[model samples]
Target: MMNSKQVIEKIKEENISFVDFWFVDIFGELHCMGMPSYSLSEDDFNDGLEKLDASSILGFKSVNKSDMILKPDPSTFRILPPDYDPSRKNARIFCDLYEGNRAEETRFNRDSRGITAKAKGKLKEFGLTHSMWGPEIEFFVFDAINIYPSPYGATHSYGGSGYSIESKESPWAKGNASTAIDLKEGYYPSQPKDTLGGLRKDICDDLYRYFGIQVEAEHHEVATSGQSEINFKYGEMTEIADAVVTIKNVVKVKAKKRNKVATFMSKPIFGDNASAMHTHQSIWNNDTNRMYDPNDSVAQLSQEGRYYIGGLLDHASALCAITNPTTNSYKRLVPNFEAPVNVCWGLGNRSAAIRVPMYLKNREKSKRIEYRVPDPTANIYLLEAALLLAGLDGIKNKKDPGDHVEENVYKLSAEKKRELNIGSLPTSLKGALDAFQSDMKFLEDVFTKDFLDAYTELKYKEYHAFAQTPTAWEVSMYTDA
Candidate 1:
């Protein structure tokens, strides 16, 4: 990796006409400011970028008096592909924010990227070399989405002919062999059944060419109407987070080109499977796999692997705030829907929160545990980092998450589940927030107190906003009265 000065000199030598400084706000929205290439002198680059009123980025600013500085992380610098803007040659770099004159003393508490970097550092301090992550991000493509708000009524309607699976009014549904598929049952169906197969291919191709992300595969998800998933090869924690954001952006742009709108909302349609970002993770030592064991007694997972699961289950509630943070997130967590609501792990089981994948047949290097709670709407940086910290904590304590539950947790009797010590996740966003508040230590390890407080405040505001809005259900129930 080049130093700041060297990075700047190289950019100039390469004739890059624009520099894009990238950073994330408290809500994990990616923000950027661009500077002409001529303005970025070697001296200016060495001094680093500066912004006086960075409190605005905190998403909880009232006074707006805080001073903040942005220093670019040279390792994250990459040239923008020609496809995005052909005429203006561009390079992008992720920035680290500092609050004080002494760069080492001041840290941006709300900086998601910084928190992730700190988490990775902590992992190394505990003798771990690398943390791998594979996030299966699911999303919905709608032809059109309309939102209406008023004191008397509120409703949202989504319609589109491009990706609609089936409807009496849809011409494509009536014997249109090339695009027709059974509504709500299009999982892994190739060609004709996969209506958006071409769209998925285009999205993946653009992501790989522009961002250099290695896309493993993509397919139509179980949800029949426009639900899809793209799987990227596992990368380091931070890199994977960056890739997540990039992939989302690329997919949305592709959808827009085809007159469609893409959404990562956990649950967009009633009675349809919600979009989720099921994360698969593994810990690795220096060039060695730490989670794999050929001699394991159960599911071929080593002692370390079991301990990692123990940590995740123990801290699952607290982790929910970062993993499944939105109000709609709970709608997907309900039972009998393939979503894992029970705190347990099992081999080849989709009902368990932590699933030991059976797909890694004959591939020891690919062995890892799948954490099923997260959604694509989450801040990928914070989510992956928090999981790494929790797993490390587990290893330090040598925690053992006992025997696997082979039977479906939803099918188990209440008394039987109680005997087995199986616990359910929070039923609502409010419950998740409460859980996060009670378990502050885990979050504190990676985030400053101010950042956590600000984040909680923002989320509370969102919750209340949703609460104040009248839903269509309310009108149906009250109109008769």
Candidate 2:
């Protein structure tokens, strides 16, 4: 809640020696440039500018056009948590990417955070005062990882087996020869069975104390070998995206400091379950939550709420290119993992892509919808902005999302789904890309044509790269046959 002047005064009074000006490449990879706090002048605070080589970043610039500036947002400054290094007096500020050195510089078209800002402004302009997001980013922690040059080189050990590991802190560990948590059975056990509880609590505490992230709940996830999920209070689109990046960074650092490996890969194992980002969102205007109504036809979800869900479902396939951006993302979206595969809205139904939470308990302010098709690997800023835009379009068109399912959609027969006229989500990254190509109008205003073209090219290249690679299964099936 501190302004730039207040932040500067605090740094001086607190004697914070180090400051890391941070930003992300187009691929959502965190990049940091450091400087002594004393070296930063008031102009740095006013202009929000720093120079960098954009060519070094993916999806940014060619080698021939590498010059760029980073404009740090003053509101994003946070003192780095002292959990890992108690003696360090470090702070971090998130930056926006731009082309020129002046205060009125043009933002690089692919600046992910800049896109979020524009999207936030668009929401207000479109009659949605503010869009809020709450996401549970699931991840796994491993004792040790090793790999070689076969397939999955350098990180293959992380895939398939041995994930239900017994680490030093896990009560099940007896010098690495003890039993591990059984697959698909690691949800909320006490001390011994759930070894990740302490780590989750530590992360929650540190995130709140240092970064002011509002941590609400923390617990173990469905996967046995240290899969975890932490819930936090919702905020505006940009801040929530910022918190997502901070969450990933803080968790990775905290794990490393404890000799553990924390990974957010969607499908680390084949059978059990995979990590997902179930994002909850609501649109508000003039201090009123428009998504809910006390005297609605059903569940108090206003017509606007259903229309928004309709818009999301209408563009669900296209949105996947941003929400579930990676190839591994489809592996998590498949059937039987509690991840949604149907492009349908349901009241409290997990199998449906959009779930109208019944826990609102008639609290109009507590109303929102949860979209479960996303994963942690996504660029959060883009994903949040795209979702808001989709919902806005839905409002404009008054798209009608049929009444909620209220049942497990997976349990329904294919014929039954046909009877209800429900559609299914795309099955692969390629399919999602095609959908995005076809329905790009929803994103045109938010993600410019240039940005979309570049993003599509990069993603298609990634898909083809993965597609052409022969998998171990193929070799095992055909080498001797």
Best by TM-score: 2
- The true-versus-predicted C-alpha distance at residue 44 of model 2, in Å, is 0.9
Clashing pairs in 2: none
Estimate every model's Cα lDDT from 0 to 1. 0.78, 0.84
The whole-model C-alpha lDDT of candidate 1 against the native structure comes to 0.78
Model 1 misplaced regions, further than 4 Å: 1-15, 58-62, 81-83, 100-105, 149-183, 360-362
**TM per prediction:** 0.89, 0.93
Which residue runs of candidate 2 sit more than 4 Å off their true CA positions? 83-87, 101-104, 150-179
TM-score of 1: 0.89
lDDT string, candidate 1, 1-481, tens digits:
5677777777878899998888878666778888887787655554567754675665734554466777777877777766456687888887777764564646666778889988888877767888899999999876666553333333334311111233211234456656554545668877655668888998887777756888888888877557889998898988888888778877876887778788898887667678899999998888767888878756678888889999998888878888988888999999866898998889988989998998755467888999998988799988988888788778888878878889988899999988988998998877888888888676577877787888887887877777776666666678789
Candidates' RMSD to native: 3.9, 3.2
Question: How accurate locally is residue 263 in candidate 2, as Cα lDDT from 0 to 100?
Answer: 88
Error of 1 at 349 (Å): 0.8
User: Candidate 2: TM-score?
Assistant: 0.93
